[model samples]
Target: MSRPNLRVNAPLLGARRSGPARLLAAAGLAAAAGLALPGPVAQADTASVRCSVPDLVEAIGRANGTPGADTIRLAPKCTYTLVTADPGSPANGLPAITGDLTIDGNGATITRPASAPAFRILFVAETGDLTLNRTTVSGGRATDCPLFPGEGVCGGGIYNLGRLTVNRSRVVHNSAVTTVDNLFAEGGGIDSDGTAATVNDSEISHNTAAYSGSTPSSAEGGGLANDGPLTLNRSRLTDNTVSVADNTDSFAFGAGHAAFALTTIEHSTISGNRVRAVGGTALAALATGSPLPGQATSLSMTDSTVSGNTTSAPNGVAVGGGLGTNFPVTLTRTRVVDNTATAPGGTARGGGIHIGRTGDLTLKDSTVRHNTAHAPGGTARGGGMSSATGGTVRTDRSHIRKNTAEAPDGGTAQGGGVFNAVGSTTLTRSSITDNRAVEGGGIFKESGTVTLNDTTVRGNRGNNCAPPGSVPGCTG
Candidate 1:
């Protein structure tokens, strides 16, 4: 398919000399300093070339074969659209940057085909030190074209399999669709596998990973998926989704997973993303060779907020709405609140947060509140926090309050504030208050040793007919 002809805008030079007398004064100063000189001191080798989207891509493709260094500059207000499918040839639509190349967008907009092949807009594989500055990549999605089904697999916005640095750029409204055996398709905006990428002062939002029709099911990353060393400084990830059916026969172990990383989220806002599985948000590995095991997903946050996310399914399957961690999940100076998980009865159990077995969770100077779990005449426990077998959770100088569990009568509703099953828990200098459930309104402990020190568990009410349980510091 032929794309519309793109108009390449010319580079805008700085303002020219207005008055002739001023230009003469600048020339006289040069004569006094050295030999003859022309106008104002010509700015040092800061020459900038301007090109539209197609011209920029063409220049990069030409430089890919050259043996020297090349840098392509994009003009401001310029837009490039990807309309054709993969031409079934190497170096076809594949722009290359061999040396240190800087594709300065100059505030340009690069768009992709809206229909399919949402995987990548600019595939930068085998590039050496690529830098994208002040550019915007949008409307890209991952898809397997009938002509080249398995070829276009990876990154929806920009696939960087090399050292990449993106500064002051925006990657939004992209998606990563499903492929063949790859059950985990991530990075709705950008996907980097085994690459070193740093995104600074950027926004990656409103992207999605559509894996609803994949065999064996899969997890979709609404914002980003990184299987490499990725550092996001001063960035925001919000409003993404992964849709999957919530049934034993149809619920094939994939959907609504972390759009960012199976590793870590540091100093960023991972809020307002929706995942359709039991635990919709982030899922980290537990131990190597076990199921999903890796220490790379260790999210260290300071002054960040993870709130206002929602997860929904038909049957009651326990969905960890915010994050699903299989390792030591730690939060410092963070706030996790106002997230919801809705499951009928066999869909979900934990509403806000779900910790897996053999994982350690630590929260300091944080708050987890106002989360809800709707069971509808079934057993649902741990509205705010839920831990599984062999899990260790510790919270210090924090608050866990105002969470609700609407489990029906004669149902097992335990731990409205905190729920621990087959795991060790420690609460110190914290507040667990105003949570409601059928039993263990404040705290629920099942086959796990819980140690509480200098904490207050107050105003939490259980079913009126059920007998009151022990409050913090008030042992019956």
Candidate 2:
């Protein structure tokens, strides 16, 4: 769970100026440069920065020079466009945060010009803690990093190695692209390898992560990639993309949200995201964990919505159009709908949700509906929900309906509602209806156990249950 290399050998301003002399020297530099530095707001530790990019950079450098935590108030509604990286960090537009700092944007913006050099907007070191409020960070490109060759670029908008919290903010129009083999282009919007990162009342959209390598590479988390604990509340992550142009063994994963550690999402929305990879694709909207059982993570969602997500893997299997999980998951009062998964020449599974072989899911008071899974030249299964071997899915007071699975090119289509392959599926007080498939319109049992308790499986097309006696209490 290591983050991208954001380190540089540039010296800090505090190295030359410390204590009262540093403050005096900073004020002298500002005065000599004809800079209008605002007086302290409420406290001596607070510095009100003007709307200029140079002012912002100098303020950050001053804050880094201070010993304790500092507060920086920015100009209202002004967009500070940076055209060069800070001398302290070669990969960041602003100086690297070396200590605790809070920036009150006051509805302003911090961005890098599209024609500027390749660098991210912000970088927080391991000992730094950053908090942003009412800010907008956009138009950052982390690509072709000469500082760290072969490591690939990451965190186009912001990179964090300590505690980071963002509130009432937006991160958009950022990109992370890599040109090396066996490298990664990760976190188009934000990347965190810290103790924790939280986002509340914010939006992350229009970000892209693309990997173009002939060897085994990966493009992950078009919106965010967190290697530590992550929590999202009342936020939206939409219209992000992860694309891989390698037919070898490359992967494109988590177009909206990707995390390798504990992830919790509440009252949030993840929609309109896409993933396209020739080697493989997973979790077009939300995904977590790795393939290894020892490193499996956990995800919990409450009162959230995952919709209008898509996945396309023409050369390989497409799994989990809306939610692709490889660890433990629990969804309460969540809705996963209107997702599409298509693999024209390969297998397609889990239009709404896919539970991997090592994943066990619990759904309570949730709905998985109006999803489609299509594979014209391969197999299609689980238009609503699917589970692999050794996985278990339990639903209580939930609804799975209006889902379709289609395989029209002499391929198999099974489980329009729920598919259990060598796994266990148990439904309690749930309904699986209005689903369509060539076979097993309600429930498909492929060498697994399907138990229905106080659940209704009706109004399905083709058939209610495959093999007639596979799922007890469910009949056409």
Candidate 3:
């Protein structure tokens, strides 16, 4: 009898053994009989194929089967717009790019809908390193995805669950909104969950997190939210906002902290972000809930700039303006300027920066200036900076000046330059001048131990009702 011909499906490997198995055996016999294979077998080290959006999308979907054989290179000046038909299922939204794909924009922009759910764009879940150079990922909405709440409604621009290297790219105007009550919203622009994300000379700005129904709790990073070791080298985090109640509540919201577990910011700028709480311009006034139960958040800035940020409370009450709960913030070769926390009744303190509640803050080779705490009825202290209630602050080789606190109703105000309260403070080789406090003038100490070495306190004015024997330095 004549041998029967078998047909084999190469792509259907590992499913089941049937006629295809005999076909593979026949193919092996044919190969041994000096017959070449029909399909072109891809070899290793093949050049990346330049592909369009559709081609690239298809390649990503087939990445699992193809493995290391596929590489899609995007065209220069081409823009890819991703659209999904189903609102609930974002998994069916866009193609998953795996297998060493290089989708270069060539200085082009990728535009997506700002109202679409998260993961509607490129999903980099593969192990291959994805690089976006000189590209712009903008205008995506991360909201109300029932399919994948955690991963879907995050990183509206590009959801990177793998290693992402973004160079000179821009991630802007992205937002994550919560539909269900009590669920936290996070990462307006990009959400890196324990991924190795290196952002070099990039800009993450103008992102937000908006929650729904009855003062929903939300944290908008306004840029990038990372739960990993995030390194921002020559980057800018600007104009982020977190809305919550004022009072000690807002400090715990974890807005900026959402972007990183451990953040190392060098030669960068974190400015113009708003934290709405009870006390005006005070992060301590918000009801955001702290990262640690009794401890504040951690922000370490070196050779960077944090300026033009605003923290505001409701109408009444006075709390931390610049920083919320203190939380071990160390600043070296940095600048914190032009920040304000305004409270009614003139009881606001720490207009520029607020150190509170066993929080430890240290400033070395830095400058804090042009911050204000405006109060009318009660006392307003620390025009430039404030420390309160078991908070410790130490400054070395720094300058604190040009801060103002206006308390006109005869309430005692202190520390136009520096305010130390209920904690230990040490200042060395620092100058505190041009600060006006109604009571202590230059340096205000209340229930704390202060040691000043090689420091100058001058040109500060005490108000009319200065405490009996209290000048700028020695108060009674």
Candidate 4:
């Protein structure tokens, strides 16, 4: 959506002035010294190629072979639509990047028409480092990528094996599908494997990754899949989804869209993202992953908002509607609210947050409220949080309130606010209030070490503690 009159930002202007713009600004000074400079004097000389409207596929093909980290400047106010002339050829969409490249959209858009085959708009190879500025990558569907034919499709918009940088741009409405049933799909918008991706001041929204058939399907990172490091700064990820088939042992991750590696998010908003599976053995939504058996996967958020993200499998156990991790998660000044996990045929746990087996969760100055977990046929546990065995949860100066855990089939509902099972739970100056459940409305402590120092439990619908003696100031 950053079209003509995109309003040059200070960072973009500053980048130009410092890098290649020096060739012009300093030209006057060089001319005074009677020195003639040929071109950009950067480590790898910069090349700028202007794109033609309907021939962007060829333009991208040419840019892929550029000598160095060059720039491709598109024509102002143009939307390049790519179509396939040959349906059988694997070389259909834009060519894969073979070298370092930077695309300056200049208010243009890159998209493939619906008539084209299911091809991604981009492929950043291992040797290709891409920096996209002021553009949009939309409506790409990677159904069959010839490079790795047997593997399930990935990176509907872009597959990055090298470094990727997106600034002042948008990646939306893309999809990654399994050409053949039962395969895995990942990163409907972008997939970064063993690399570093930095997306700032942009929007990645409305993307999906899915599969069908009686066989199993696995989906990760609906808007993005990161098996490497990923950073989102001042960006927004909204309304993305991953739909996996039922009756499989599957994991649907990152409705707001992130995963598997160290992820750092600052001043961003991830809302209205979802993962809905038909019926799987176990389904973890929002974000799902575990570190090496002994190692830990980390998700760190600062001053961000994670709200309205959901996890639901029609006939499977649903966990972590807002977020889930098998390792450790650190949230500072973040808001987690209004997330839900409802299992029509199975049980639901942790409508807001779920700490997997062998996981650790921490929240500092954060708020988790107004979440719900429902089990229509089975048991519902932990409306706000559920920590499994060997898992620990810690909250410092945070609030967990007004969450609900329900089991409509006359099952069991425990811990509308929090549940600790064979895990250590600690609260320092936090409040758990107004939670509703069948047993231990405020907290269900079943064989865990619970220590509440300067914490409050009041106005819960049922008992405050499961055993009535595990927590101080709580009586059944």
Candidate 5:
């Protein structure tokens, strides 16, 4: 896991096996059987990559040509630059994984040349299984492609439609950009569709997503755009961005987009992620599901810290500088600090959390502080959180302080702390203090039922809220 300070490089979880041991494991097996497997002694042959294979592409072909559950044990500390003559249907480029396979990179780096065609480093086809061990994938660039029926291009670093797991790996400095109108760009580092890509002891950082298209399309998920299930443990996502574009109908999302997916993150850190759209979210787990009673989507974050993230729709509506979800979201033992959601010419809301779907949002033992929602030409509300109709907002043993919601150009600004509009809100054993807004500085109730128990509502900048003995603590 990354340290609280962002300057250090966290190492992998466990030590890697030595090269000598791996090189000799196959030799020992062959000698014990009184049979000789003639190949170079530098790499093991427990799987498919032969010692005589010239390059990575051939090795991939050889491995794919073989049957199920193969492992391509690569030479130690090698760098394979994948290239292709025809990238669309490439004879080169990492072959699409056909079945279950493990690439024992042994600390290798698989990348592409600078002058190569815009291509991703890896693609996991449907029903294929890929496990990357101790490797690095970088320098990928995905341009406008017809992958989304002339509507979008995604997964600059990795496009996965299957199962992908990584152990002790890093995916960095990749990008996905689209210039075609009516098309969108997603997943500067990775885009997973129906792909349960799990990462352990890994880092995905420094990726970018730039899309300048028309309305009704989003340029989102600077680090990862997941349309399925994604889980992370002991990982970091930092320094990623979704650049501003002409998107008006849809908003951009950064860090990770659980737009139509389920995400679980634990012991992880998301920092320094940025987005600039007409009105979008930054560094949030966005759940865009209106399910049928039993098909709800959600995000769960435990023991995580989300800091130094910015989301702005400078000319549109901006919500959720830290998190935006339409379904159930739970934040336990989490800290969301120093984040901003700005809408300079439009509406801005929810500097920390935006609950849109009609579900319950629970925050336990969490801290939401030092966040801001600013609007220069429009209204601003909910420096800490905003819950729409049908959603139930609950906070227990939490602290929400030092937040600001302001409209600089004579626009209305209310709900500096919390905004409960047509919802049910409950605060138990929580602290709300030092929040500043134009009207309600502690909690705002447009039309809702609020219940407070053992909660502290004090030190707010405006005396807009009622005394502690009331539910839905504020009245405008």
Candidate 6:
């Protein structure tokens, strides 16, 4: 399919001049200073490139040098395999996009060969504006950043620092690994840091972010990591995995998606994502609403499904197998189900959703069910939903059922349906039933208040509520 070209006007650089006059001025200045001057600026052009890596590289270079936004059309149904990194800065397969550029991929693929050295596929600088349409990015690996060591190596497929839009694209089979200790590897598929990115009708799946250090290290966002304003519409992030060393101080977060800024998700699915950690908390699928530095974040999700996600921390804590948040969140018509959180020698909390100390969750018309949390040698709490200190959870017309919290090896299990630890919980027109736990099978209030208005809590195993009369209108 052909995409229409978008024409952009060139910016006026100080003052417009004729080509010959500008060349003469540049030559006279170079002669006076005895310094080599840059080449002439190229005009914007819509070019079609053949199925060659060199042609693609040259086309991107020309587009980057153009004054206005240039559109490069890739050869249809062709695979442009990159075997080596660009000999320029950032060490990407193609030149780093520095200006407004768009690549109209007519069902074409641009990927790195499996035997290629560790390098990202694309990088968009802070002054760039990149748009990708109908493209596939795969088989990219990012190891480290020599130029910017503090930033570490991130975004195996595409790294965006300015503005980015991806439509009808697939980002899969990419990896970002950290070989050294304390250094990090983030965003196996894409990373947009302190920028704006929108993904429409796209799929990001089968990506990995791992830390291979002998000691402790961190790995985050197997599919995507964004510390900026991000929007996802009609998209899916599935089957992504994040792994960290099974040592102390190691951490892995958000195997499917992680956002530390304001984010919006509409008609999206985050499913089948996994996380493995040993000494730090592992959040499996979605980790949004977490504050970044001094800025607080929030998430607004509608018509979304977060299911079939799993997290395991052998000697550490596992929190939120499906969704985890720390600021504020609003969910409408969403479902969190079939997620598992396991911590064999540690604590396991929130098999479905975990709200941190500063989090406030407003769930409307949503469902949390079929989730499990197991801690064989430690405490297991909240098979469905758990909130930390100073958190507030409000549910309206929601259903929480069929969840399990088990600690069979002399450990304690509490709140198979909902766990509130020094937090406030209000349920209006909601039903909590068929949950299994050793104590507080329906709802657990650990020094917190529980308010129920027209809510039903019954059919739970072990006990309906802890302390016999802790929760009003709930039977033990």
The parts of candidate 1 lying over 4 Å away from their true place are 1-51, 66-70, 85-99, 115-119, 144-153, 179-184, 245-266, 278-297, 408-412, 463-476
Can you tell me which runs of candidate 2 are displaced by over 4 Å? 1-44, 143-150, 291-296
- Provide TM-scores for the models: 0.77, 0.88, 0.74, 0.85, 0.83, 0.88
lDDT of 5 by residue, 1-476 (tens): 10111012100000011112222343464467576455443332355443332466666666666655667887777777666532333422577776677898788887777788777778776657888998888877775332343456778788776788988888888888876765667788887764477988888889887777554445667887766678889888888888645545454665544344567889998888877766533324332333224554677889998887877777677777777666677999999888887888787778877766455689999999988888887888888887744578888999999888889878877778887778788889998888988777887767677777888878787754633334454343
The local lDDT score (0 to 100) that residue 91 gets in candidate 4 is 32
CA RMSD of each candidate after superposition: 14.7, 9.7, 14.6, 10.9, 11.0, 11.1
TM-score of 1: 0.77
Considering lDDT, which of the candidate structures 4 and 5 is the better prediction for this target? 4
Which stretches in model 6 have alpha-carbon errors above 4 Å? 1-44, 145-148, 292-296
Once model 1 is optimally superposed onto the true structure by TM-score, how far is the C-alpha of residue 249 displaced, in angstroms? 5.1
In candidate 4, what residue range of length 10 has the lowest lDDT sum? 10-19
- Candidate 1: minimum summed lDDT over ten consecutive residues — where? 9-18
lDDT of each: 0.57, 0.81, 0.57, 0.73, 0.69, 0.81
How many residue pairs clash (N, CA or C atoms closer than 3 angstroms) in each of the candidate models, in the order given? 27, 0, 32, 2, 2, 0
Candidate 5 versus truth, CA RMSD in Å, comes to 11.0
Please give the lDDT score at residue 169 for candidate 6: 95
- Across 268-336, the per-residue lDDT of candidate 4 in tens digits comes to 988898887656523334464555433335889899887888888767777778877665789899988
Scored against the true structure, residue 24 in model 6 reaches a CA lDDT of 39
Task: Name every residue pair that clashes in candidate 4.
Answer: 246-279, 247-279
